[model samples]
Target: MRVLIAPDKFAGTLTAVEAAQAMATGWLEQAPDDEVVTVPMSDGGPGFVDVLSAALGGELLAVTVTGSLGEPTPATVLLHEGTAYVETSQACGLDLVPPERRDPERATTYGVGELVAAALEAGARRLVLGLGGSGTNDAGAGLLAALGATAQPDGVLASGGAALAEVTALDLAPARARLAGVEILAASDVDNPLLGLRGATNVFGPQKGVAEERRVTLDAALERFADLADRSLADAKGAGAAGGLGYALSLLGGTRVPGIETISAAVGLPDRARAADLVLTGEGSFDFQSAGGKVVSGVASVAGEAIRPCLVLAGQVLVGIREMRTMGVESGYSLVDLVGRERALGAPRDSLVELARRVARTWSR
Candidate 1:
């Protein structure tokens, strides 16, 4: 039997490649006669650069950029020919900020601009930016500032979203000049607009530690910046992605693309999974949200089209079996079911391997 293992990163625990490898190792340990093919997958988020770099054999270029909080951050971009893959998580990922210090009003995406600058310097005219897992709600103010947009005399640019209300002037000529010949594609996980109830500040602010008391303030700031910077993209699709970094890019002629589809095409996932007898895909947690536009959902759809059996192995399973069946997954397993929650969280790799071995033993001939 040929088994294709393609899964997204397990959030903070494992990369997509590492997860695929672990599942393959465990499956082979039990079913030695079976063939396993691994394909790491991402939805243009944290693992975007790493997965594409490995699959496309792109060169990784290192550069120093500003962090979410103005700290010096070492980052790398994947360059394949003239196309550059830049993951915003490399600079302003929520994981980079501590649990206690996560402040949507304070975090900035200045480092993204620095990375783009580095890619431009390296002769890249095609830029694909992965925009997700951000820790800011500045509507890309920091990014524009880094790309040569002048800041307010009162230091408004470096500050987070709340400071956007103090914007005194705008100078986008330099920033637009830098990206004149470049084609920018921002892969987004969400399609919310820049302002309103479904906007960045209201929908995503809480996850980054913005509370009711501060929500109105940040929303107003983003609105202020949107009006001052680019009122055209205020209601654009994906403008809310990555705490409004998508909005910033949209202001500079950046197009928004669905992340999973872009990645699937780049890695040729459908063609690879077509010949496999079974496909196993998963994530950190499998829940109702998994039915939406996620890596697991994308993988399952591909497998379904090929008439192949698809199974899922998750860290914590919340969706029901009928729901799994509807998604074309023959069955599903969660580490939390085999092992306790504590053990699953504390030792995920071991639990994942054990689960894979069990699945192979039960189903693989």
Candidate 2:
């Protein structure tokens, strides 16, 4: 049997490449005669840069950039020829902040700006910025600040969402000039809008440490900022991603595109999946979000149309079997359930390999 092992990063535990390796190793150990191929995947989140770099033959370039909390941190950007791939999460990810300091209101995207500046200094003619896993709700204001763009006091400038209520004006002249000749691409996987229940503040604010009562305030603030910027933030797909960074990018002449499409094209996933007898895809968690445009769902969508069997092995599987089946996933398994929550969460590598080996043994029979 020809099996394709394509899995996303297991969040805190393993990278997509590492997960694929573990699964491949386990499968090979149980079925030595079977053919297994490994393909790592990401959904334009934290591991996007690494996965894309490995698949696209790009070099990982390390640069010193400010952290989400304004601390000095060493971040990496992927570069190939005149194009640089920047995963904004590297500099502004929630994981970068300590639990006690997880305040989305105070967090900033300055580090992302620093990375972009460094890439531009390196002579990159084009830049693709992946937006996800961010800890800030500055709407890319901090990013512009780092790039020497100042926010107008009367323009829709807000700190987090609550502050948006105070926004009345916007300043983009400096930013426009700075980014004049640069082509900016905002690669995102979400379709959520800028404001409302399904918007950035309402859906993602809580996770970024916004208090329950503060959500509305933040949402309103983002609304005002969107209005002053003269951009139609309402119902704009992907405008909710990265704390309204997508909207900010749109205002800055950045084109928004699906992250999976870009990564798949770069890695040649569609062609490879077509040739495989079985395609395996997964992520840290599989639920409505997975079906809502994540890499695993994207892979499943493509594989389904091609009449290929796709299996999923996630760190945690929250979706019901029926839902996953409808998505064309032949089978779905969770490492957490298979190995117990503690073991799966604590020593994921060993547990995942063992589980994969057992599963492979069953299939071999």
Report per-prediction Cα RMSD to one decimal.
1.4, 2.5
Q: Which runs in model 1 stand beyond 4 Å of their true positions?
A: none
Question: Residues 157-273, candidate 1, lDDT per residue (tens digit)?
Answer: 768888898887777778988899799999976899999899998998888889988888889888888777878788999999999999999988899998888888888888888
Model 2 regions more than 4 Å off: 153-169, 233-235, 362-365
- Each model's lDDT: 0.89, 0.80
Q: Which digits, one per residue and each the tens of the lDDT, describe model 2 over residues 179-206?
A: 8888998889888888889888778888
- Model 2, C-alpha of 350: deviation from truth (Å): 1.6
Clash pairs of candidate 2? 154-168, 154-169, 155-169, 155-170, 156-169, 161-218, 164-221
